[model samples]
Target chain A: MLDLPTRHLHGPGPSPVPPSVLEALGQPCIGHMDPAFMRVMNEVREMLQQVFGTENEMTLACSGTGSAGAEMLMDNLVEPGDACLIGVNGVFGGRLTDKARRAGGVVTNLHADWGQSFSRTLIKEKVAELKPKIVCFVHAETSTGTLQPFEGLADAVHEHGGLLVMDCVTSLAGRPVELDAWGVDAAYSGTQKCLSCPPGLSPVSLSERAMEKVRSRKTKPNSWYLDLNLVGNYWSGSRAYHHTAPVNMNFALHEALRLVLEEGLEVRYARHRRVHERLKAGLETRGFRYASDPEWTLPMLNLVSIPDRVDDEAAVRKRLLLDHHLEIGGGLGALAGKCWRIGLMGHGATDEAVDRILAGLDAVL
Target chain B: MLDLPTRHLHGPGPSPVPPSVLEALGQPCIGHMDPAFMRVMNEVREMLQQVFGTENEMTLACSGTGSAGAEMLMDNLVEPGDACLIGVNGVFGGRLTDKARRAGGVVTNLHADWGQSFSRTLIKEKVAELKPKIVCFVHAETSTGTLQPFEGLADAVHEHGGLLVMDCVTSLAGRPVELDAWGVDAAYSGTQKCLSCPPGLSPVSLSERAMEKVRSRKTKPNSWYLDLNLVGNYWSGSRAYHHTAPVNMNFALHEALRLVLEEGLEVRYARHRRVHERLKAGLETRGFRYASDPEWTLPMLNLVSIPDRVDDEAAVRKRLLLDHHLEIGGGLGALAGKCWRIGLMGHGATDEAVDRILAGLDAVL
Candidate 1:
């Protein structure tokens, strides 16, 4: 049998999951259409709606990772010849743009510097000019550890009679993701990050407004696997069979969501913020500063500069893995090699975890 | 916490998983970029190639269910305006046709009755007329329990200068699927079926000929999540990050593949046939007849007519589940009220399991 080494997962994702979630995941899988399995799906859908801050009946976890959720929304909502305007500031935002185009949407990108957040005023101007049918933004940029605020962004898009879509892969449970409060139409999140689940399922939700867009699509969804119109029925509605869901993964997500609700969202967010602050203070004293703007930095994913004193960053990370069994993320895209993203998410968002990374960095560098 | 009842999974796809594979799935997750986890992925890829009977270097598991594998092949291979011919016999083949059309291909479907296999001459005629870039077939139709054979089908498509794609979801390990010998260019399978693993991952492989088509595509693949060119680099080449992989799920697949190899493919195939023969003999004695042609009935998935004495088939199935905890599939698509799909696949293909189902039906009826 193949063997795997256990490590403290403190990367951008997947953060460390608790033992109970893993236990639930290991349970024997029931049939997809079985009443017992359908009950599990219903429970997961209900809990995910709570975590995502939406009461939309279409809330459910997709079978693939977080990225599949984004694809589901884009392919189902963006019809051929529809104009899509997306705010691009990181890798995920760029990916959403690609999905929109593949769905045959006429795409226009609203660009921002890496590790920076977009302003609502600028988006309003762009929305007025493009009059796009759909507008997209990344609520939390995993590649840059930047948290975008939806202060007036949704209203701006709504003013133009367009739906608001979001990539909430990094912000769902670790931070505040009030989809209803923000008037967001559609959003998707990762199970590994804040839910403290294994990374296989993507919890996604769409407002009635977003479902309306999908219902009125001019063309069928481009990808059948991620087609919400069909998949949604399997999760709820008439309880049809769209595909064989990753049964065990849903088991894990159900447990993970239960854990989040048990701990409560506000408490989870506070815990993340506290640990991130601890890591921030320790890094600042070690001649490291955040790669993202202070105002836009995310609590769950901390992007910090690699000091010049550390000549070989990869070697340092390798040593940390070998010596401490610790895992931290290297910078991605524009910030690669210049910074490191240290995650304090879900079950990993504790003083012990944050201190371990700091101590490992001290011993290695 | 959400609770799930353990059922004897004998469905068409999610057959039955062993305890050992579930244990591997519950192991602590490591980072995606961690060398240890990468070794697990490498092992899975290697074993998948052996199971697929090919030297395709692009063999890897997608992070979704069985359908995701089909979507990966169709979305990556079928570009806009490309002529494609697909054989439609049951639900899965019709699904492949749906996928090809969504990928912007000018798809021509050669229709076959449910539970019927397509003839090589019929496909050859269609290929000669369309001169398609790709031809598709479902090796095992789960919906109808028909086992499609590649006698001269591959040659017909190849002679017409096209790639042959197959859905081997229900046949990969339980039945013979000689991708290389059959001249198959691409194929995909499910972990839930013959692999005896939980449903969530789809094992897929593409020959160099198929990869060449993907590399030379005019437009980007619709799905960023299933994009082979990008995801392949993450799995092998640079080991760069694509998305957060389902870490523990890879561990489970590695263990599942290990079991397949240890059991030996020939012995496993013989075991499946033996148990299926047992069920067939018992069912024939009990006034139940196979819904498929005797020559083409799948050994792993037995579609049998619901006895006329059982006026309410759903009630019988519910009684079987509630009383014996045995889960069997009701007929789908065109055969909804007419038959039951009795799956004896992978770990579920055993004398004891087969007898248990027969006893349950005998008692319940």
Candidate 2:
């Protein structure tokens, strides 16, 4: 067997998986419907609801990556010419709009500058004009490390008789996501991000309103695997087998959820916040400026402006990988080469890991 | 963390993973581009090529389950109104046709009875009439445990100026695929089946001509993550990041591939065949009949006719699960409750497992 390298993952998602989670993942494989595994699966659902802070019955992990969740939500919520409003401030928001359009939805964008949160007034104006069936936005934009203020946006969407679908891919475990309290009809996140599991599955939840819309959808979902109705039934207590659950990955996710619960959601969130503050302070002392303002910054993934003299962002990333065994992310899309993404997520948010990254950066600089 | 129950997995695809592969899967998480992990990834690519018996450059594993590979192949190969021909004899074949149609392909089926293989003459005749851009078939029909002949079909597809896409999901490591020798252009298989890896990734390989067609596609693939051109770059030497790979799962696959290579391919195939013979003999003693003709039966997955007196297949399956700690598959689609699918695959294809299953069946009967 080819051997694995020991390296601390400091990238956007898939932070260092704890040993307990790894042991859970390596457990004996079980049938998707085995009573024992099903018990764990059901527990995972309840635990995820606790993390998402919602009581959505349709909540469960999709068998693919985070993007698959985005596509699944779009496929179920929108059909041909169904008006949808998307927040487009960073790479993930652009993806949401693209997926919405691909699903035959008429998409209108509430544009914001990269690393800048959308103004509540602008969001209100867009909602009033488009009055779309769904108002989609990212709670924490990983690409620019900006967290959009969703309280006003959610209220605006609801007032206009629209549902709010939020992308909490980077924020769910690191920060509070009040799905019920904030009126989010649908939300999706990755296990690898703040959840600190490997990156193969996406945890998604839908509110009662969202489930009702799916129940009353005009078309059969375009994709079979992502069809939430069938998937929901399979994941529910009925335990009807649909597709083969990624058994090992699910085991890892179950452990991840267990870890989050044991640590206490509030404690874990505070841990992430503490690590973010330490890392940010260290980076600033070393002459770095964050792309997002302090108020809207994501605690897990930090976006920093690249110095002009850097010249080759890829080379610097390569150096970090080779010399320090540190894997930081590069800016994506329009922000490429101009910003770097340093993540402090899940297990990687520990103080030692933060110090290691800072020490590596000091040596490199 | 929920402890995994020790159970024997003799189901359709997510067969029991070997202990070595499981151990490898639990190894610490690493960056996808870590030099050590990259070496493993490269080795995995090489091993897949060896098992596939082709030097195709685009051989790599998709992050989702096997069905994702099936969907991705169709999404990349077919466009709106493109004429495509599919063989429909069992559940998986029907699914292939359904997915193709959903992807906007004008699908024509070469019909065959369930639990039976089609004649080469009939298939060639049907393909000539259809004049399709792509001709799809399943090497092993999991639902019916039928092994269809593909050598003649591949030649016929080439003669008609069409590429052949084959689902080797159940056949790859269990039987000889011979991609180049058989003239098949594209093939996809699940890791859980014959490789003894947990079900999370599907290894797919595309011939040069098939990839060229994908590269020159008229429209963007509906699913962004499944797009071959984009996903290939992630696996290619350039190492452009696309998505966070399920790192631990990839480790499991690498070790599984090593096990396959260490136990020679021919020996592994012989072992599967031997265990299948033992099971067939035991089942015959219990008054069971083969669902398909012996000549066309797949050794990896066997379909047995349900007895007339024994009704409620669900009860029997449930009893098996509860009493024996064993899991076998039931027939899907039209054959539900009519047949039982007994899989001898990966780690499940052992003499001990077969003996235990037979002992349990004696009580059920």
Candidate 3:
């Protein structure tokens, strides 16, 4: 039997889930097709729509982690020979490109520097040239802790006759995610990030036009388990049965959404911003710098450049874990070892958690 | 708020978890990389190995549902232009074929009737002809409750110089899965089925040969999250922390595996078989016939033909929930509404549960 250690999760996602959500997770398992469980599923779907700010009827949680949702959406939306315009500014953006290519879509990438937002000018030019069926970008890139503003990108895509898909994995609960208001045709988010829930399910919603494409697909969905057309039938539309869902995780997510709604979306966004502001002040006081531009940083995830003298990032991380029971993330891909990503998501973004991380870094530095 | 109706789950999966496992789920969330939590992860990995009957160093739980594991293995193992062979006996087998093809593999499938086992001779011939990179099959088809015996299929695969991957999602805990002894190169299982854990993580293991292929891949895996080379870092050597694991779900699984091991693997296997036998007797007494062959049926999941008079499978299912508060699974894909899948699995396979289901069914019938 494994016992959970007492530690403050200051790393990205798998944040400190509220005790209420944990209690919800322990509730007894139910059949996915059970009327009562389906009822909960319906409420979860509605709540997810509220959070995502979408009226898309095809909204439901994919039975996997965040990236699986990405793959599921891509698998159905993009097919062989279809051109896809991908905005690659971080690891997750790179993933969308990879998934599209694997699905036989011809991927055209609009590259951006890691920890940087997409340039609308460059995207508009690419859209004009490639004219892809779907224009995909990450709203909040978890790897680089950068938020890409797409306030007008969707309109650009629509003008070019392409639908917009966004990755809201890190932004869904922490900030305002107006899927419909922002004209996002398709989007996916993880439960573990700002939701203050354990990582497992990925909530996805698709616009009516996107739903039509899925319904009238040129080919059968390759992955039957995640074939959203059929999955949606189970989730909605008469509550048809599919595979067994992660019942307890759904329970946890439902409770997490309840908390998010209870706090109100605005309050949740404010909480994230407040903690990030305090943490930023403390880090600046400690002479640390950030990787992402101040204007584009995610409130819940802060990726900062490590000081030159911090030769061994792993050692520093180990020290933090041993001395302060604080867990932080090291940079990935090209940024590996150069930056530390400190997260203040959901229950983790508190004054005490922020102070402890700063103090731990101070001791190590 | 959607209230969960109190129900007895005898469905194919999302099987009713033990109260202990349920209690474990509600425990406070911990950081995935927390040292104590890593120890818990280590226990889960080791116990998974014990259950899998493998010494594969790469054994770890992927933080997704069973289908995600299937997608992960397919993405990592198969690439563009790679040839693969699959035996299609039920929905799962067909889904695996779809997954393989979606990952850009040129798939050749040998079809078997639903609720029927494969002929090793035919598969061996196909193996000789196709010479595929991967030969895949389902050990236990949950939809039809048919157990396909490997027999000499593995040796044939190795003889043809192909790696054999088995979907043990419905077989692992309920049956004797001797992975190393049987020469299976890679395999995946779900926590929700025979393990009696909630569905969030998929336990997967790979042989040394499979790991070598993963290490030597020419292209980056299509799905970044499911990529074994990267994910293995989080689960094994690199411990690089690829993604935030579903912390509490892992705790629930660790405890579930402990319960599995504490009872002794053979004892647990026998317990599942014993409960299945009792349930089968009860179902037989009620004049219900199993869809699968008697010799090839999986004990954990029983696929029974619903009576023709029961025109409304959905209504019966609804009535079961509303009137009796018991849950069972309807058929999927080709088997939809034609049959019902009843599960007798870990903790949920008690004799009392069997009696309750029988009584409930009698009242409904």
Candidate 4:
């Protein structure tokens, strides 16, 4: 038997899952097609709709991680030779560009500084120039801890007769995501960050408009596992057999979603904001500066530069994990080694968790 | 709170998850990139190799169900315009053809009856004729409870310079699967079937020959999520971050694999065979004939014909679930309502479970 030491998950993801969700995950396995499991799946779909603020019947969980949801949408929507424009602000945005290209879409990249959100004016200009069939961007750029404002972007794309796709991996449950109200066509999210579930399933929602594009595509999506028409049939009332649903992970997501609804989305958002402020203040007192702009900073992931005196970034992070039993993320890609990501996500966004991470950082420094 | 009643889990999947695996699943989720989690991943990879009977370095769990593994292999191996041949004998075999087509493969389907296994001579003849880039078949067809033999098939495919891909979802741990000795280029299995873990992750393995094809592909695999190169980097010694792995599901799979290795594969297979024979004998006394051929039937999933005297199949199944707390599968696709699937897989392949399911069926009849 292997000994697994428990650590406080304050990293970018696999954030501290609640006991209820873990308990649900450990519940006895059931057949995927079992009526009992189907009922649970129904509840999961309903709760996901409430959380995503979408009335779309296409909302469901992709079996893999958040990346799977991104692939699912891109594969279905961006057909061969279809022009797709993406805002490459950070790692996730860059990933979307890669996926779009792989799906055989003619991709056009719109660039923004690593920590900066894309301006609506810039997006509108791109939409006007490229005449893209789909405009993609990250709602919350996990790599840079920047939350891109989605206001007017959807409408701009819609005006151009294009769909707006957003990656909400870091934003979905931690903040307000008005999918219907914002007129967003397609969006995807991970369960770990804001939902406080272990990472596995991706909650994806496609508006009827997006589904229409999928239905009218000239060629089949290159990925069989992610073909929405087939996957949607399984999740929809048809209950057609596709792949076996990851039953236990779905159980965990169901419980996590139940907790989100129980807490109320507003209260949960406020809690994340409150804890993030506390952590930010503490980090600032320790001579830390945020990498992202204050206005665009994500509440769930706090990206802060290491203090000048802290020369060994890896050692500091190692000490936090080894000595204090706490985990925080080092920056990824171009931001690597320059900054640390302190997550205040879902269950980890409590006052006690914030205090512990702050004290651990102080001790390590 | 929703109450999830415990069932006997005699369905095709998810067969009863063991207590140890469930306990491991309930353990606190840590960061996906955490050192401790990485160690567990290493152990899982090693154990998976032992179970798969392969020295293939490219073995890891896809962060989805059995079908995700299927999709991963097809997406990576069958590039656009690549010729792929699939043996469509059962539901899973038909799915292989579908997935291959979706992956942009020029598909050639060889059909067999629902419960019949594919003949090696037919596969060799097809391989000689089509000279496909990839040849796929199911090792165990869960839908019809047929176990296809792999003798000479891999050599025949390899002789024509085509890769052999096997769907070992129901066979891996329940029966002998000599991946290296048999020269199988790629294979994937579900955790819930023979491993007795809850359905979440799919264990996948690829031979060096299969990976060479992936590396030499002209186009990037359409799915960024299922792309093996990126996922392999994360699982391999490089440990490059691809996607946030389902940490707790990996934990469950790790523990489940440990249990399998600890029991010894041969002992486990013998146990399954013993329990299956006991149940088959009991069913025979009730005039319940098997749908699959006697020699080629799967020990893990027994597809038995429903007696004509028992007209209310759904009611009988419902009564078993409600009154006896047993869960057996109804036939899928063409065999729907004509046969019942009684699974004796992994933990459920015990004397006690077999006796209980048989007694319950007797009561229902």
Kindly report which residue pairs in candidate 4 clash with one another. none
The digit string of per-residue lDDT tens for model 2 on A114-178 reads 99998889888989888899899998998999999778567778877789999999998899998
Judged by DockQ cut-offs, the docking class of candidate 2 is: medium
Candidate 3 residue lDDT tens string, B1-365: 43667777788887878888988888877677777887888888999999999999999998777887888789788877889999898988888887888777999988989999987788888999999899999999988999987757778788866799999999988889988888999999999888989888899999999889899988876666688988898888868866667788888998999889988989988888889999999899889999998889888899999997887888887788788888888898999879999888777889999998898888887
What does candidate 1's lDDT look like per residue over A1-365, in tens digits? 65667799888888898999999999988888888988888898888888888898999998889888888888898998999999899888888988898888899999999999998788889999998999999999999999888866777788888999988999989999988888989999989998889899888899998888787776788888888889988998999999988888988998888899999999999988888899999889888989898998999999888898888998988999988899998888888899899999899999999789989988998
Clashes of each: 1, 1, 0, 0
For candidate 4, lDDT tens digit of each residue in B176-268? 998998899999998989999988899999999999999988888867888898999999969999999989999999999999998999999
Clashes of 2: 1
The DockQ figures for the candidates are 0.83, 0.70, 0.55, 0.80
Model 4, stretches more than 4 Å misplaced?
none
- Model 4, residue B284: C-alpha shift (Å): 0.9
The residue ranges of model 2 lying beyond 4 angstroms of the native Cα positions read: A308-312, B309-311
- Error (Å) of candidate 2 at residue B263 is 1.0
Q: What clash pairs does model 2 have?
A: A14-A192
Per residue, candidate 2 scores C-alpha lDDT tens digits across B72-103 of: 89888887788998999988888888778767
Report i-RMS for every model: 1.1, 1.3, 2.3, 1.1
Candidate that beats the other on lDDT, 1 or 3, i.e. the better one: 1
